[model samples]
Target: MNMKWYEVAKIRMKELDINQEKLAEHLDMTKGAISHWLNARREPSLDDIAKIMKYLGFSEFVVNHDGTISTAGGNENVSNLIPYKPGKEYPVLSSVQAGCWAEAIEAYTLDEISEWLESDAHIQGDAFWLKVEGDSMTAPTGQSVPEGNYVLFDTAKEAMNGSLVIAKLTDSNEATFKKLIIDAGQKYLKGLNPAWPMVPVNGNCKIIGVAVEAKMRFL
Candidate 1:
C-alpha cells in the first residue's frame, strides 16, 4: 500500500523544515503522539485530520470515502519557496487576515523583501502568503482575481477603517475574507456575498497582513 497518511505528513513536514515537536504543537498533540502517528501506530481523528490539513496547507486535498486522498490543485504553489536556512522565521498569518477578495495567512519568506518590487508600494514588511480556499469574493467581471489565489502581504500597513481586510472571528481561528469597517464602537467585517450580510471580520479575526498584490494562476 502507499505510505499511510501520517507517514506522508511526516515527509512533507520534514521537507518544510518543520520538526515533529513543532508539528505536534500545531496538532495539539504530545510529542510521543506525533511519534506514534509517524510510526503508524496511531491515527488522527476526523477533527484532527482537518486541523492537520490546515497546518500542512492541504485544505483542498479531498478525502475520499475509501480513506484515500485525492491530490487536487489546492497546493499548487507549496513548491515555490526557496527553502529556509538558519536564522530565518517567516511570519505565519491566517487567511482572512488580509485581502480584498483573497485572504492572506502566512508569510513564506525568511528576510525582509524591500528590494524586490518595482516601486515603494511593493516593500514587504513582516508579511507573507496564505492560500485562498473559497470563492465568496469572486467578481463576475474580475476573473483576474480568480478564486483560490494567493495574496502577498505587508504587515506594516495600518488597517484603516474601511479597507478590505483579512479577519478572523475570535470564536473561530479559521480565517475569512471580508471588507473591514471601523464603526466607532464596533468594527464590521463585511462579506461580499449578500446572501450572508457582512459581519465583523476584524473584531475577532486576526489581521495577518494588508494585501500588496494577489498572485494566481491562469492555467
Candidate 2:
C-alpha cells in the first residue's frame, strides 16, 4: 500500500512547527507509535488519521484527485489572528533589566483591559505582561493595582489626564506606575492616596508602556 495518509500528518506538523513526537504527546500517544507512522513501517489506522486531521483543524472530508488525497483545510484562508483569551499565561521578560529579566518568567496574560473610568468600550492596545511594584501612585488607583498585580502593559492606547500609567524615570534606574498629570510646563506623578506626595517629573520620564490590564491570582 502507498500509505500516503502520512503525508497529511507530515504537512500539518511542519506547517505548525509542531513535531511528530510533540503531536503524539498532544494526542496522548507513545513516541514509538508515532515513529512507526513517520517511518512508514506501519500505516496509521483510520482512527489515527481522523485524530491527526482534527488536530490540524481540518475537516474530515479528504478530497480525492487521482491517487493524491488532500485534506479539506490546508491552513489557508484563516484569519491567522490569535484570539485573546484572558487569564492565559504568557512570558514576562523585562526589557529594561536585560540581565535580570532575560530569563522570561511564566506569567498569566489578561484578555482585555478597561480604562481608568471603567468604560468597557474604551479598550484598545496589544497585551503585554509586566510586574508592578512601589507605593508612589496611591491617590486614586494603585490600591487595586496593589504591590504586585502582574500588569498587562500597552502603550498603543489613549487615556484621560488622571489615568494611571507605567512610566520609566530616566535619571533614576526605575519605572513608576503612577497617575498621569500633564500641565503647562510641568509633569508630575500623582499619587492615589492624598497622604502620599506627588513627585515632579522631568524630560526623563519615558512612557515605556501603560498599565492597560492586569491578572491577579489569589491563592
TM-score of each: 0.41, 0.42
Which regions of candidate 2 fall more than 4 Å away from where they truly are? Answer: 1-90, 94-126, 137-143
CA error at residue 27 for candidate 2, angstroms: 38
Task: Show model 1 residue runs off by greater than 4 Å.
Answer: 1-121, 141-145, 170-172, 201-203
Residue 216 displacement in candidate 2 (angstroms): 1.5
Tell me the lDDT of model 2 at 200.
74
Each prediction's RMSD over C-alphas, in Å, is 17.9, 18.1
lDDT tens readout by residue for model 2, 14-49:
655556655775678888988886677886766786
After best superposition, candidate 1 residue 81: deviation in angstroms? 31
